[model samples]
Target: MDKLKGKGKEAVGKLTGDRRKESEGKADQAKATAKDKVDEVGDRAKGVTDSLRNDDK
Candidate 1:
């Protein structure tokens, strides 16, 4: 969601020739990508824990 919004901002910035806006949009995209990676790692960790518990049974 945030990634998409950031992409839109980037496109709009490019269309309007706003360097500041483009930089901001790029920053937003980078932040969002980092967040997504964190979330993915967390989810995989949770899955591993669940699998380990199930195997103990």
Candidate 2:
């Protein structure tokens, strides 16, 4: 969702030739990407825990 919003902002900035808005949009995208990576790592950790628990049972 945030990623989509950031892409929209980037598109608008390019259309309007606003350097500041473009920079802001890029920053937003980077933040969103970082959050996604964190979530992916957390999910992988949870999967490993679930697998270990099942093995013990």
Candidate 3:
């Protein structure tokens, strides 16, 4: 969502040659991507935990 916006901004900045905005957008995109990856890992871990618990029962 926000990451997509950042990507769009980055692309626009690249097209316009605005160095500052481009850098900011890149940073935002990186942060968002990192957060998303973390969330995905957390979800996967929870799923595995749940499966193990169910198997034990």
Candidate 4:
């Protein structure tokens, strides 16, 4: 997602000669960061569930 946004921003900046690429890059990075956080949370939840199941033995 961040890469996509950066590419898009670069393309648009090239087309329009605007200096908004920095902001776009930041937005892309934010999206990537959020996605990583969500993935981490999911992994933690899965780990907890697996541990609980194992303890049921």
Per-residue lDDT for 35 in model 2?
A: 99
Which residue pairs in model 3 clash with each other? none
- The residue-by-residue lDDT of candidate 3 on 16-45, one tens digit each, is 999888888899899999999999999999
In the predicted model 4, the residue pairs found to clash are none
Backbone clash count for every predicted candidate, in the order shown: 0, 0, 0, 0
Give RMSD (Å) of candidate 1 vs. truth. Answer: 1.0
Highest-scoring model, TM-score: 2
At residue 18, give the lDDT of candidate 4: 73
lDDT of 2 by residue, 1-57 (tens): 888888888888999999888878888899999999999999999999999999999
Instruction: Please report, in order, the local distance difference test score of every candidate based on alpha carbons.
Output: 0.92, 0.91, 0.92, 0.81
| Of 2 and 4, the candidate ranking higher by TM-score | 2
User: Which model is ahead, 2 or 3, in terms of TM-score?
Assistant: 2
Ranking by TM-score: 2, 1, 3, 4
Compute the lDDT of residue 56 as modeled in candidate 2: 100
**Candidate 2 lDDT (Cα, whole model)?**
0.91
lDDT tens digits by residue: candidate 1, 1-57: 888888888988999999888878898999999999999999999999999999999
lDDT of 2 at 30: 93
Residue 31 displacement (Å), model 1: 1.2
Q: After superposition, how far is residue 8 of candidate 2 from its true place, in Å?
A: 1.0
lDDT of 3: 0.92
- The clash tally of candidate 4 reads 0
For model 2, what is the error of residue 48's alpha carbon versus the real structure, in angstroms, after optimal superposition?
0.1
Off by over 4 Å in 4: 1-17
